[model samples]
Target: MLKIEGLSKTFGKGTLNEKKIFSNFNFNVDNGDFITIIGSNGAGKSSLFNAIFGTFLPDEGRIYLDNKDITYVPSHVRAKDIGYLFQDPRVGTAPNMTIEENLFLAAGEGGWFSIGQKKKSNEFKEKLSLLNMNLENNLKKPVGLLSGGQRQALTLLMATYSKPKLLLLDEHTAALDPETAKKVLDLTNKVVKEEHLTCLMITHSMESALSHGNRIIMMNDGQIIYDAKGKEKEEQTVQGLLNLFKTKEGNLMASDRMLLEV
Candidate 1:
């Protein structure tokens, strides 16, 4: 239930350093659609999320969520409708805040601690218990003390704590070890399925994009160049997709590990 029409952005306008990030970008996300965005560095994958999440207002274009124009909506206001998790797990949780406390303050659902003792601890414990990862017992633990995977999984829970309409994951598993990343990715998939959350996930690893999401989109020069889903994506190898880019859009040089990581 999101749409982007004629979206474009550029930096350093009217100067020798001018760089245009995207041009006439367009895409529509369906209810519960899990879209994996894959592209190399400087490809505008993260920029697109920032643009959508209100971190950066594009020089031009319109962003709509459920048909309401949110082009100028401040990031804080948009937080109620959209959730973003950065590549760094630390970005999602407050290290100094206890697990229950962090969830308590998420999206401003509870009263201020001084207003009245918020009674969310029990409800939050029940929710965390569903993770089957012992996070329920660590409700009072500082998020910074968690392992990378745990923090990422907890961040997943935090992003959805308020049930935002859409979730934006920007290379959320990149920093973890392969095993930890897989665990976090699995947690992400489970949560999305359980909640029926519509999501946009940016990733460099083609394997991840193909393995986890229902759809995969290939982007270049700040525009979507290839879009496929489900069985359509299943038949192709990662190398096949890379070659397709070569044939259709010319060679795009990205890291070898990035190609292999997914």
Candidate 2:
């Protein structure tokens, strides 16, 4: 469960380039809710995640997770309860490290130190096996040698190994080919359901937003312009969502990436 109230963020404040991103933005996410977020470029989708992840302090307002305030909590402190997968696969992994080594570090989150002796545990192997990518046999292989999809899958596994309270997916599959993206998305869905994790995913594809999550949110000009859930979300088609965006914002959806994905 996450709640944000009166959240405001601005960059280059009081200068010629002063541009406000969020103006009293407010949102609430329920426990175990899988929410897909969509918007054109500069809709503040990534900024919203950055604020929640404590990448920087917001100018005002508060954030709470499971009823505990974490607005000003440092990113390292929040890392234990939050799992983040970046759009770039390389960003989330240590390229020089072996696959098992990376996973060992992930599993040891919130710990002061990790014992190298435990890297070969059956638990680790079992988890790797679930990927169905034959990564279990390549534990000693460097992560840099993996394909894009394989590395992303490993990152997903590492991120969820501890079953954090929330998972933040920032276009995690956008870098892959269509088929590979679908595989990764399927794996993501499987893991999220198995863990019953609360998730917030930012995606450019209208089809992805409508197809994956139980809830869909549209952002425009730094505010949530539309939010749909349950039957409303289930009944939505890509064309209908595009029409809704046009109706709400009185402008055509203008992202080439989003348009092409649909």
Candidate 3:
């Protein structure tokens, strides 16, 4: 479970370029809750994740995971409980490293000195097999040589290998072609379900936001403008969400990427 209380963040504060991103933003995520987040550009979606991950300190507020405050915790410390997948496949992986090697580092976060101590273990192979991407057979292959879809699939496996308390997916499938994106999304859904992981995924597709998670949230300006769950969320459609956004923001939705993708 996670709770964000009265969170606030600003950029270029106390200067001519001062811009507030979050003004007393508040949100709570329940245990094993899979939440998909959607918002226009500058909706504070990335800022929210950055604040939660300790990429930067929030101006004011507290973030609690399973009742422990982690607002100011160092990113590396938080990495133990949080697994993040970036939009760019190249970001989360060591390109020069073999697929199995990258996973070894992920499984042993603080054991970097033991990097060369082990090769691909049966357990690692077993996990890769679940992806159905045939990566298990190429464990020794360099990650950089794989296709974007393949690399992203490997990154997802590495990120979830330890079953962290929370998984942050920052449009992890956005970079792939439509077919590859669908495959990656399917793999993501499978992994999340099998692990029963609490997840927060930011997506640019209304169809993706509505189709994947049990809960859907819409962000606007600096705060959560709409939150839907259970049957409410199940009943939602892409058109309905777009209409809701227009109603709440009193302006046309601005993200051309989202519109075109949907």
| Runs with alpha carbons beyond 4 Å of true place in candidate 3 | 109-120
Candidate 2 — which pairs collide? none
lDDT of 3: 0.88
Q: Over 4 Å off in model 1, which ranges?
A: 107-109, 112-119, 252-257
Q: Per-residue lDDT of 1-262 in model 3, one digit per residue for the tens?
A: 8999998888898999999998788899999999999988888888888888899988898999999999889999999999999899998899999887798888874564455444446677888888888888998899999999999999998889889999999989989999999999999999999999999999989898989989999888888988999999999988898788878878775554464375
> What's the lDDT for residue 87 in model 3?
90
If the candidates were sorted by their TM-score against the true structure, best first, what order would they fall in?
A: 2, 3, 1
- lDDT over C-alpha atoms for residue 122 of model 1: 71
Candidate 2 stretches with Cα past 4 Å from truth are 109-120, 253-257, 260-262
Q: Count the backbone clashes (under 3 Å) in each candidate.
A: 1, 0, 0
| Tens digits of per-residue lDDT for model 1, 80-151 | 888899888889789998887788787465554644344566777788877766899998899889887788
Worst 10 contiguous positions by lDDT, candidate 1: 109-118
Q: Write the per-residue lDDT of candidate 2 for residues 14-76, one digit (tens) a residue.
A: 999998999899999999999999988888999999999999898999999999999989999
Local accuracy by lDDT, each model? 0.83, 0.89, 0.88
Top model number, lDDT = 2
TM-score for each model:
0.92, 0.94, 0.94
